[model samples]
Target: MAKNPESPNPSLSESPGPSSSSARSNGAPASAADPRSARSAAAPGGGQALSPGASSKHTLSARKGQFLISPRRVPGMQAMGLQPLALNVIEDTLRSSPDIEVIDTVGPKNIIGVLADGMSESPGVLVARMTDQKATVLHQQAQGRLIVERDHPLTLGDSMPLQPMMVSWSAPTSGQSLDISVTVLGRDDAPVADAAVYLFGSMIPATGTTDARGQVNLSLFGETPQTIRGLYVKPKTDYWSFYQTDPDIRTDEPNVVGLRPLADWPALANFPQNQVYGWGQKAMRLDQLPNQYRGQGVRIAIIDSGAATSHEDLKKIRFGFDVINKKTNPDGWSDDTVSHGSHCAGIICGSDNAFGVRGFAPDAEVHACKLFPGGQFSQLIDALEYCIEKQIDVVNLSLGGAAPSEALEQQILRAKRAGIACIVAAGNSSGEVQYPASSPNVLAVAAIGRLGEFPQDSYHAQTLTQMVDANGFFSPKFTCFGPQIAVCAPGVAITSSVPGNNFAAWDGTSMATPHVTGLAALTLAHHPDFQNAFKARGPERVDRLFQIIKASSHPINLGDPSRTGFGLPDVLIAVGLQAPMGMPSGLIQRAFSGAAQPQMMSAQPGQSMMGMQTMSAGFAGPYGGFLPPYLGNLQQGLPYGYGFGRPGW
Candidate 1:
């Protein structure tokens, strides 16, 4: 690629030119010194190169694909042409690094193919075993070779304790000696002769020594029970017991064996959680919901920062557009101008894997549409337009600026016109509910603490003074409060996959936004008919689904209009699939009688506050041993109603 002199010095995506203030806010230093100028002396052609003495104490790193090679210089070589010396230095350093093994040089191939040695800590090792993507080692100790694969079950902590091979077995007999044979093979598949063997059966002694053919025979005597078991020929250490055995009388079942802990079978958290960002073994239990709508065919567009498409969790991502760079880097580069985009992607459709965490709709495909790194109104508009052009079903916008732009608002309206569901985050500034969300068309999500705690309105500073923390009942210190917020979910301590196959936890309305996006995917999956119906009815299908979601929320009146928009969104209710449970008829009658405003009700009622509605039968009333209390300041205000005007006795 020859240089385009007229092009901007730094390769930034096409965009409305940034204002002077915007550049300053992005931390651009005002200094005009060209650091590369000093390098000319080191090159034969007067090309730029830094002298060893001139090297600054701080060395900036350069990343190419998965490789993270630091600053260094190498003598020019004909083998690599006259490429930057830094690239060769990094390659050489990686070759010697214990944790990395260069499978091949990409320069000659024009295509790079490399794998991470998860078993080692090489400075240049790129792939990680427990990250969003998983790396499988071809041999033990992760030393032989590595392969980056998509199977989620084979993760860092997964191990096969026993190797497949043949071992002899003998049932116990009364007053008769029991004999058994066993063999252990090496990588060559050849037997290791003279190995020790231990035979164990119910009420029988186990002992043995192997012959030259790698065969071992064990004899035991006792009122041998029908059940029998066996163990390896040799023990690794005297302190650690070498043999294991189990006795099951049934001929069809194999005997059970137990190994004593020589060392704790290392905990999953200990196995480089930093790589997968410690997404625990458990993923979001979508099966636990009312329906398991496998999102096999749905495409959800994540319009934010670029995604780590190569991430083990997101191997199925489809690149939509690079509104910023104009060029496509589908593997989502770690050099994300903003991190919010990636975080939102993880929450919506993060790959379900053994080593890392899972997403609500793990099977749904992703379309990475990078728009705003730090909230550009125009970029948001561009991304919305891009999603509409692509016909993406779900568009997740996790970034929001000061206010909604008319252009941005109209784009959202247009998306709804085209049957796209837009999920926008309630801004984190604790400021007023911003655009898109406030536009009444977007599903505006607010941040809620682990136990439904939301920040009190910061605007009412004088009123906030009267509130005091008790039982840790106070709202999250930073959660934004507003009427624009539709629902809330676990926004704090949200862990997701990050670049470099690592994990990080972040909190914001940004975190809450993905839950809604994921739920929408599931909704679409279950009700594909709804989508078809939309095609028949045109854009109104967008609001129809929105109405379904709004009608299904766990309503709570927080007194303050700016806090919870429609109450907490109930996914099951939104999708019309709540399970049936028992309820009291008298309670239901009283609830409706107490209501003055026209009420939309479910077919039944239950003691739960989720997934069921009814003017007659089943109503959620605190089933599952816990009842939702009256919503916010409403409990203190109107004695007859909880919050949101839900009738009370």
Candidate 2:
């Protein structure tokens, strides 16, 4: 792809990709200038690849990473005559690179190869994860190989975690376990079923889901209530998550807790959040669009925590990859524990079956890629490779990392070349945009909130800043802002599906990105210019798509271009209804190729204000008895409404 000088952010010129994998078939190290040796130990929790001006001296470590060794250079956007390389080629490449540990290997036949050499789930997938300078050297030398990313950490913090994405519940001590029954209710005094209830006790942590009667029986380690640390009740949807630091427990009687409903505002009784489309859907004017424009022909992928396939609305989402547990439970990708991916899936393809919430593109083919709780960059890159091979037209990435990965940048370029569009979150740091989203090759979206769309006194109200515009839409104070923002969408108090046939109304740019991804699917399925192969199939197709979406968007009067790029994209205006335009040869490509903004590489190392961000009922409040940076920074981590609207840090 060619670089555009007139782009919003001036990006550093990218160096040519590393040498082809075939070139290093001899296993000898390429010189320091070329730096090619395919082996290094994997760092447990990897950091970002260094930018210019940072100390070049780093532990040259590498870990288990997928090795995409192909015999030929990558083909063009239209890979005409492309054929799978011979198996000997793969065998020879592995034989030559002894330093590159072979954790997994998937061959052409989907053969039961020794996963002691673990590889991609299916054929056409071979992975070897690694990071650090050793990983960088290997990637650069093995250019012809598809990609070798760090398997860097990714979380629902829709972010990359500083620690390995592993959190464990303590097993109970030898003392007798006591059973306690708890009931969850909504503000309307209605029983809240399918809600996740957690009890953080001194010696034991117990968790359970509320049943139809809104009751959950929990067994604690001690007979007395003294072992309790805290209690957290998270509803499936239509209510706020409730957390109590300490509570007076009367084990003798039934315990009950109530949550605030998302639709509690007396003035907006007509708006039933569960039955009606979310404000985000209406803001994009999905209701105004024709019934025929549903995302029926598009393939959309969401990389986040797993999703709850049992959810009625998300039942259409059958295709998935459990990147977290690929080999063990390859078919268990839909096992959403965190509920983040389920939310994004609902926003994109959730159906309108029997009192369920409808998505922007309810008919689109949905593929869920679970990587939350803990995900790595290497994992993300591998997922992208799957997307390219899977013919995924659009992908939603509602996660971020503290630092940038040059390997990821190259992979994004490849995905773009392969004609896949990536929609990413701008981050919730209240600072410059995060990587991937900051990459000009992708579309980065910020979060915007409209007044009266949520309960006035609920946690959702905490996101209201004084920045309201004439239309009542305000740029959230937590949204990462910069010249890289491509657009804004409804992120505040967003109501979407969680795990276990439930729903939750939350905030963060993570909640905003899916709107654009869903819209992109609809555009590809219906927009005239994107309807045919000639106009839509090419390296620059997404760039052209971005041009159309941005050019046709109506920006809210937020008065900050950094906060709201082209504002919200209008679906009707894009799909040839409101303002249809003639499709000329390379018309949009020529003018809009350079319009994207990817200016992240130029920032000084550590200037990135982003930290580990995980979304848990992000209503302003002080949280975290765990660790710093992991749960630090309100704008970065917990932005709940605490005293004076400050972070827990």
Candidate with maximal lDDT: 2
> CA lDDT of each candidate?
0.44, 0.63
Query: Model 2: per-residue lDDT, tens digit, 252-354?
Result: 8779988876555443243343466778888889878877778887899998887798988788887988876887986788888878889888888878664
Indicate the worst ten consecutive residues by lDDT in candidate 1: 151-160
Question: Per-residue lDDT tens digits of candidate 1, residues 1-649?
Answer: 2223233233332233332343245375422233433332233233445553453333333211221112111111122242222435545644553334343221111111111111111111122112111112211222211112111110010001221123334444556665544554432445544334555454434655545555555566652335454343342211112333343323233222222221221222432222232211112224356425656666788877777665666665756667655545534433444455666677777765654446767778778876544434444555665665566778777765443333343345556655677877766555655545555456676655432221121111111212232322123344565544555544554566566454444556677778778877777776545757754322455555555555544534444434544445555554556721222343233222322111322212322221222110111121111222322122233222222212211
**After superposition, candidate 2 runs with Cα above 4 Å error:** 1-100, 104-149, 157-236, 241-257, 263-274, 532-534, 580-594, 597-649
Q: Where does model 1 exceed 4 Å of error? A: 1-287, 290-292, 327-337, 372-375, 451-474, 528-532, 535-537, 556-561, 579-649
